[model samples]
Target: MTSDREQGTGGDLVATLIRTAGRRADPPADAYRAVLAAAEDTWQRKVGRRRHWRVGVGIAAAFVLLTAGAALLRVVVLPMMAPAEIARVDRVGGGVATRPAGAGAWVPLVAARRPLHAGTRLRTGPDGRVDLRLEGGVSLRLAVMTEVELHAPDLIRLQRGAVYADTGSAGPGGIVVVTPAGIARDLGTQFELRYAGDVLRLRVREGRVSLQRDAGELVAAAGEQLTIDTAGGVTRGNIARDDPDWAWAETIAPVPDFNDQSVAVLLEWVARETGRPVHYADAAAEQRAASVILHGRVGPLAPLEALGVLLSTTDLTYEILPDGTIEVRYQ
Candidate 1:
């Protein structure tokens, strides 16, 4: 048998060993819980960072798109809404006045080179004459006691009186002249249209014109004249291109720009303005005309007067024949 003291001591040692073994066999549950919690926190933080980055990128992209769209609207949409320019009041002579679209007050147009827009009504006094430089290389001359309305760049309304039009060589667009009795469409021509007390007259100097009436449509070619009465009866006749009746139009003709232009070109312009054909005396005169350059201003003279001034500088002389031919000869 063993003593009591030894037995107690052995029992104590056995108990200590058992406790140490239990501690080693199982880890603390709190430590495992803390590690799992830390992992979840780290994952949540990473996801939040990614989401914030995406939201920031999206906002920036939206802002950029909105800015670009606004810029595009400004550049593309505004111009189309602006009104088109038709013709300008190139020259105002005598007593010229205008009544704005709907207004009754007649504003005296003392200024030259004023711009005329659609719906503007123009009236000239008995002594008044106005010249208009239309768009597309077209020109118009309004005679005395005339009333006209600019409907658009390519359309005009002649209430009363006469107007002359010249569409240059480029053939930009057909100009429509609306009269009380009929409508005249220019076919790349120089022509005169007159409207008075139930009578309409059309004289084509060059090219052709188409006249439309309620009764029928009539085509008038160069050197042709047509008269339409209030009864819609048509009377056609032949008229000389350089008829003396066209002299009033020449009085307000625009002076040709002669800077570094050839004599031949100037002579051709004179011929057109005077409603005459240019005739060179011989081959040498024609060659000389083609070769010689003209310089200087013609001042504010009529076409014939300006022609006289221009030819004085060269060794050439010209005469207007009885049949309206401008014969150019060597001095």
Candidate 2:
């Protein structure tokens, strides 16, 4: 019962509301694309952050490992690699060599002035002899069938044999010789220490030495000899410094390099070797010796024998006094 114009207007209004509602329910294609792009961007950012975190962790781990390795090298590896040199092998006669620490086989050591490190074990054949020059001008002579260990520059262990130590003028920093029976400590002295089966002997040539055992201790001065028995009993007696028993030591004594050295220097060496003071016939004789320069080699000769050869070049002769003094005079 309504007019046609009113009915047409009402239909148009209804259609317009329906179109607006459809547009609100379904978004445009551009808006859907923008939402997908934002989600993809957020996912890519999260992946990048995780990758950066892994790289940072790896770098930190490597640094820690490097630091730990360096510390280990400094503390343990370097020290084991570098053992200190305490002595030098000056001479090796017969079949003298060294048995390295923790090694069973013996290695033949040639006389090439090889450096000897601490804890090196030395062994000699039946006819062997070896001479060692320790730090601080000390000399150690080992006789045949002897075995010794270098504990330090100022210390040695006499396992089984004889050793002559001359700690020349280097004030003793506790030079010790460890024997099976006892220990002999030098007081800036020259001495011979022998260790055999269940016995140890010490003979002081110049200066004092202290021998210690579980029983007690005794000091032996120059020209004194002490023996320590297996039972730790100590016995001491007088012995000449130049006794014939010491002749073997003289035979193996180290010959000084007298190149371009003064005669006075040579005389001083002879005095030390022979354990005697040199007496010049007069002040002129001493002055002449100071002015003269010696040239030649006294190779492999005993001290007295070498002295005779040396004086034969000049018009000088020597006589050994009863008091162990050498009187040098013009022929």
Candidate 3:
């Protein structure tokens, strides 16, 4: 019933349709490409998440290390400055007026002499007073009801209150006191400075006091004074003290223990007596046949001065602290 040409054309058409259906049942080239692209995207997302986690962990570790380093700086590094190293004192802050060595209330402007350590408590009543004197005779005195921090050998940061200073005889680099506002450098011999009420008050007695700002420097000479505000603004004038507070320096007593014992034994005794810590150089030499003639406080004073006196005794040398610890060596 069918013609030959019609039958052959229909068969060719059916064969073409079967071939197309087989290709569609499997995947086309574009479909393979789409699947590959999806796999790559998922891998990339996983990699991104891993990188983010690593970065976050790294940041956390860095934060912990930084915090630990700061604590070490405050507790260890700041206090280790040499005995010969110079220091400054200033006021920081306190919720109450006065706290003691265990109050955890105040921070010093410079490393404290025996009774003071970083974790020690600080108190300032309206009449609370504190003083710091470097081995080379630089001194800083905090007024009553003040708080401060001893940040470095030459750096002190005052948070609140007032401080008087006689920055004298610190070798070479001298002394520096920092406040909530600015820094005061000793170009002169003596100065009484107060950081309170957003004002830096300066009264110069003996030498010159230099008020330095980020912008410039203001020089105050003997009998002259200046005040600087938090804004780097400075005011200059003449200020004087009838009886300078330096009278305390005169009260420093001499060590008289050297009269009975050799300078070496004296140093050891002073170290044990005063309770200030001490270190020795050339321990054998310090213990050798060392003798000295005695004089005033240099003779009867604390161990530090006693060591100084012993050194004054022959070719020997020594060092002592305000708290009486002494270290000595014979030449």
lDDT of each: 0.80, 0.78, 0.53
Q: lDDT tens string, model 2, 226-271? A: 8877666778888887677777677777788877887788889888
After TM-score superposition, the amount by which residue 161's alpha carbon in candidate 3 deviates from its true location, in angstroms, is 1.9
Candidate 1 lDDT trough over 10 residues, lowest sum:
33-42
Best by lDDT: 1
Badly placed stretches (over 4 Å) of model 1 are 1-83, 170-173
The parts of candidate 3 lying over 4 Å away from their true place are 1-123, 230-232, 241-331
Model 1: per-residue Cα lDDT at residue 81: 52
Q: Order the numbered candidates by lDDT, best leading.
A: 1, 2, 3
Which residue pairs in model 1 clash with each other? none
Q: Once model 3 is optimally superposed onto the true structure by TM-score, how far is the C-alpha of residue 297 displaced, in angstroms?
A: 5.9
Clashes of each: 0, 0, 38
Q: Which stretches of candidate 2 lie over 4 Å from their true place?
A: 1-78
Per-residue lDDT of 144 in model 2: 89
User: Candidate 3 on 244-311: residue-level lDDT in tens?
Assistant: 34333222322233455565555554443333445566756644634444433342243445555455
